[model samples]
Target: MASSRWIRPEVFPLFAAVGVAVGICGMQLVRNICTNPEVRVTKENRSAGVLDNFKEGENYAEHRFRKYVRNRTPQIMPSVNGFFSDPDLPTN
Candidate 1:
């Protein structure tokens, strides 16, 4: 003879309410994930618009890098031992 623990009748309504709440929340979560811009931008959605975005990003990065390089001043730091830049080398 085996005895199983049976759920109390009063707890059934609580379980039912929790289940309904969980179901509603789960459905909402699924809808959000499906509709999210990042999630929706999958490889399957590839098009000219995606390519244009990538090209624009590359152009912007390259433009910023070029502007930085053009505006920055170059300087060589001397080592503590002063061995990296040879003092023996004649300066123009």
Candidate 2:
């Protein structure tokens, strides 16, 4: 009668910790999906479909870091973005 489990009992704590971390992340994701204004669509706006106004400026941020950096220069790589987008291309 070889009654030995393949998964070692010593690894239970690791599995437990991982499970807790995953559970917490899942809970926060679900909460955000359900309650966040930017995520949830209003009943009146449902009919608008693709044409609905996003009003991104009025949406709530998930963290203070985002709120603080909102109006600041948002370009990740301004040089790349402005490659051919320059305003002064006096005809050659």
Candidate 3:
């Protein structure tokens, strides 16, 4: 067995937390650089007309995404209550 004389295990959580925070910050920074309307680093981005941006925003607003379950309450154990309560369920 090789004896370890390196970093302490107690500091592992701190390191993991720092890594997660750094990763989140990095993702947000990249997203802002790519999508933020005010950021016009490229020539094409700078040349885009205001009406084009307005149309893009309108396109996004007009398309509404649908959820899977409509007019239904969310449940932690989805089938448990239904299985016990359904009158027509087979009981053999």
Candidate 4:
């Protein structure tokens, strides 16, 4: 029983280290998913759908224009204006 108690104490740190490693890995995975281009595009698409649904007039041309403006604002403006920018910005 005394020997078992000593072993348990020794194993506690190992388990704690494993838990920390797993937590770090999970955080990294979440960060990667949040920053992924495909994930960002999907989120943008969903946001546009929500915005389109809320518009009062239901005009297709207006909805398209709004989506285009929203999508282009961060992407096209900086590139054309020569603002310092990351080259990996999503194109699609």
Candidate 5:
């Protein structure tokens, strides 16, 4: 039973290497997201109009995303036509 509880020494190094690689990848993804200019611009544009006032160093992405969503129409459902044929619909 004692022998069965052990991991092979060679396998430990492989697991550690994978962990290190994943950590590095995560760090790079964070860096890219934080530093991208287009993303920052889009966010800024949506939050405030192109001519709106701004405070120094304020992030505008949230406002920009909100404005963009507000200006777009909601998607129409294709199944709306089926509602007319429903048996429960009144003919009047």
Candidate 6:
């Protein structure tokens, strides 16, 4: 035959400790749910969107660098045959 006592004197403290721990955890869970605001996953908030914007800036930088290079390219040859040879070239 088994004893049907709910709280055995030897194990009552252990059961109480477990119950207290579970209650504390449950209270924290409820508190977090109530206090935390809802978060939405929008396109602007996504990492991929952020990275895309960075990539766009990188591309713009590259474009500006290429434009700078193009502007700096040496114009060794004159357009007209006697343009550079003539001393009377327009001051403009």
Q: Best candidate, TM-score-wise?
A: 3
- In order, how many clashes per candidate? 0, 0, 0, 0, 7, 0
lDDT of each: 0.60, 0.68, 0.68, 0.60, 0.60, 0.60
Residue lDDT tens for model 1, 1-92: 22234476777899899999999999767855664333344557644243335664555446645877786555455443346557875545
Colliding pairs, model 5: 43-60, 43-61, 44-60, 46-63, 46-64, 47-63, 47-64
Error of 3 at 30 (Å): 0.4
- Which residue runs does candidate 5 get wrong by more than 4 Å? 1-6, 41-92
Off by over 4 Å in 1: 1-6, 41-92
User: Pairs clashing in candidate 6?
Assistant: none
lDDT, model 3: 0.68
Clash list (residue pairs), candidate 2:
none
Which residue segments of model 2 deviate by more than 4 Å? 1-6, 41-92
In model 1, where is the ten-residue run with the lowest total lDDT? Answer: 46-55
Tens digits of per-residue lDDT for model 3 on 23-61?
999987886677566667788867884545776555444
- What is the C-alpha lDDT profile of model 6 across 1-92, one tens digit per residue? 25656557888899999999999999867744543223225545443432335564555446644777686536656546448688787755
For TM-score, candidate 2 versus 5, the one ahead is 2
Q: lDDT (0-100) at residue 77 of candidate 2?
A: 80
| Better model by TM-score: candidate 2 vs candidate 4 | 2
Window of ten residues with lowest summed lDDT in model 3? 59-68
lDDT of 5 by residue, 1-92 (tens): 76655577867888899999999999767755665433344655557644433442245334455777786557465346546556676565
> Could you tell me the lDDT of residue 18 within candidate 4?
91
Superposition error at 68 for model 3 (Å): 12
